[model samples]
Target: MDALSQALAKSRQTISAYEDYAERYDQIVRHVPNEREQASLKRLVAIAGTAGQILEVGSGAGYDADFLEALGVKVRRTDATKRFLELQAARGKHGELLDLLTDDLGGPYDAVLALAVLIHVPRDQIEQVLAKIAGSLRPGGAFLVSMRNGDGETDGNYHTVLWRRDDFAARIESAGLVLIRDDFNEGRNREEWNTFLAVRPA
Candidate 1:
C-alpha cells in the first residue's frame, strides 16, 4: 500500500474521525436505500426470508436498517463507532458496539449484512474477518457485503483498504461461504464499489 492507503487503513482503526463525523455523515446519507442497495436487500430477503434474524455490521445511523424494518425484518444493528450508535439512539433506535475483528459476534444468525463496511479491515486481516462473518451465520445463512474495490483509494483519509473481486471471492470460499454473484458500480467519487451475496451451506 502507498502512503494514502497506509494512512486510510490506519485511520479506519482509529474511531475518532468517525466519532466527529457520525452525525454530519448521517445528516448527509440518512435517506431511503439506494436502488442497488434496495435490490440487494430484496435478494437477501428472498434468501433469508423477511423475518430472518439479521445482524448488520456497521449500521451507521440506521439508514438501511430503517428500510429493512419496513419489510418486516428485525436487524441487530452494530457498529465500531460509538457516535453512530448514539445517533441511532437519538433517532429512538438501538444498536450495539461491535468490533468484528475482536468481539464475539454472538450468532448463527439467519443472515449478515455489512454494506460498505468491511473495507475498514486491513487487507491482511480480511480473511480472518470474513471467516468470523461466516462462522457467525447459521448453516444456511446469507451474507451481503459491499466494499470499495481496487488496490488503493485516492481520497486521503476516508478510504479504507480496497479489494479486488477475485481476491475477495477466493477469500470468501476459503472462509467457507458459497459465492453467489457480485455487482459493481463507479460511485459518485469514481470510487470503485462492489457488492456480493454469499451463503453458508445448509
Candidate 2:
C-alpha cells in the first residue's frame, strides 16, 4: 500500500477507538468546536438555501442533522463509525451506514454536508472521495466540505490529514464541482479551519 493509504488505514483504527465514546461525542465536541463547526454550519445552511434532500456524511453525533432538520431540511445521515451510526439510528436519523471511501452512496441530493469528515481520508484518496461525493449530487447540487489547513499526514491519533486549501479546491474542481465560496474562521481558543462551498456543474 502507498504511504497515504497506510496512514489512512491506521487512522481508521484510531477512529474505532472512539466507538465507546459515541454517547459522549456531542458533549465532548461542545467543549471545543475543534474547527469552526458552528460557522461552517451557518455557511452550509445559507448555501443550501431552501433545502430539499440533504445528505450529511460522517454525521458523528447528529448535531448537524438536528440543526438541518430544525431548519425544515430533510437530512439523510451517514457515518463510517458503527458506534456513531448506532447513536444516529437511536435518534431516528440514520439514513445509511457508509464508508465514504468504499460505499456507493447513490444520491441526487440538493446538498451534501461533510463536516470535518474528509480530513480522515488519505491525501491521495481525497480527490476520489470528492469525485464520489460530486457524483452523488444532482446537477447544480451544493457540496460543503471542511478540513484543517496544512500539508502532510498528522499522526493518526486525531483522525486528521492536514491539507492545503488551494490544493483541495483544485481537487474538488477536478471532481466536477465548481467552487462557490471558501472561508476560514477561528473559534474557541483560536482553532482554525477551512470551509468550502461548491456546486456540481450542470
Candidate 3:
C-alpha cells in the first residue's frame, strides 16, 4: 500500500481495537468533564438551535449523541468503529459504522458536530474531508468541529494530524464555509484546542 493508504489502514485497525473494550471505553470517557468543552458544546447547540437534523461525525460511545437528543436535536450518529456503532444502536440511537475517508455522509443536515474527530484525519486530507462535510450541510447550516492545536501528524495504532488554529481556520474557509465563531482552550494533556463554528453561506 502507499503511504497514506497504509496510514489509514493502521488507523482503521486502531479504531477497530475499540471493539474489545467498547463498554469500558464508554464508561471511562463518560465521566471526564471539561468546562471548556462543555461551554463549546453549549455554543454549538445554541447555534444549532433546539430542533434540527444534526449529524455527529464520530459518535464514539454516543455520549454527545445522547446529550444532543436530550436537547431535542434529531441526531444521526456515525462511528468508524463497528463496536461503538453497535453500542450506540443498542441504546436505540440512530447510528452507523462509517469510514470518514470513504463513506458517503448522507445529509443536507442543519448542523454537523465533529468534536475531537477530524484530528484523526490526515493533514493532507483534512480539507477534502471538510469539503465533504460542507456538501452534507444545508445552506446556512452550522458545523462545529474541535481539534487539537499544534503542528504535524502522529502515527501509532491510529494517526492524528495536529493543526495550528489559524491554518485550520483558513482550511475551513477554503472548504466554502464562513467562519462564525472561534474559541481556543487549554485542553487535556496540556494541548490547545480549537473549537470552530462555521456556517455555509445561505
Candidate 4:
C-alpha cells in the first residue's frame, strides 16, 4: 500500500485501540510521576516558568498534566481520543479534544508537551505536525517530546513509528526548533524510549 493508505490504516487501528482501552488505561497507569518523568517536567517548567501557559497533546487521562499543575503551571490538556477526555473529565480534570493532523493548535504558549504522544503519528504527517508544534510555541518556548526509539514501524493494537535520535532531531530542527536535550531510557524491548527536549528559537 502507499504511504497515505498505510497511515490511514494505522490511524484506524489506534483509534479503535484507544477507544477500547481508555477505561482500562487508568488501571495501567494513573499513579504519581516517576523520577524521570518528574525531572523532565521540572526542567520544562523551569524553562517555561511556573506561571507560563502550557499545552499538552495526547494528554491521556491528564497524567503529565497533573505533575505540571502540581508545579503551578497552567496546562491545557488535549487528546484526540474522546474516551480519554471523558475519563479525564470524570476525574474532575479539564480537557479538550484535539487532533494533531486536522485541528488548529491555537497556541503561542510557553511550552508544548507531547510525552509518549508523537509515536502514533505516521511518517507522512510527522513533519507537518512538528512544524505546527514549533509554530504554536512562544519565542524560546520549550517543546518536550518523548517518542519510541528505533527504526521502522509496528502495527497491532496501535500504530507505532519509532526513530533514531539523530534523524528525529534533524526533523525537529527542520521544524524550526533547537535541540537542547537528548536522552533515552531503556525499555523492555530492543527499542529504547527516546526523549528529546527542544525549544523554538527566541
Most TM-score-accurate candidate:
4
Q: Output the better candidate (1/3) by lDDT.
A: 1
Q: After superposition, how far is residue 88 of candidate 4 from its true place, in Å?
A: 0.9
Higher-ranked by lDDT: 2 or 3: 3
Model 3 misplaced regions, further than 4 Å: 2-4, 31-35
Which pairs of residues collide in candidate 3? none
Q: Which ten residues in a row have the lowest lDDT in candidate 4?
A: 182-191
What lDDT score goes with residue 4 in model 2? 61
The ten-residue window of minimal lDDT in model 1 covers 4-13
TM-score of model 1 relative to the true fold? 0.90
Decreasing TM-score order of the candidates: 4, 1, 3, 2
Q: What's the TM for model 4? A: 0.94
Off by over 4 Å in 4: 1-9, 188-191
Q: What is the lDDT of residue 65 in candidate 2?
A: 79
RMSD of each: 3.4, 3.0, 2.1, 1.7
Which residue pairs in candidate 1 have backbone atoms (N, alpha carbon, C) closer than 3 angstroms, thus clashing? none
lDDT tens digits by residue: candidate 3, 1-202:
7866865786676686667767887877754336666666666677677888889988888887777777787888888888888877787766877877888998899899998889888776787799999999988889999998998877765577899989999999999999988998885568888989999999
Q: Sorted by lDDT, highest first, which candidate order results? A: 4, 1, 3, 2
Q: Per-residue lDDT for 163-199 in model 1, tens only?
A: 8988888888999999997999887678788889999
Give the Cα lDDT of each candidate: 0.84, 0.77, 0.82, 0.89
Per-model TM against the reference: 0.90, 0.85, 0.89, 0.94
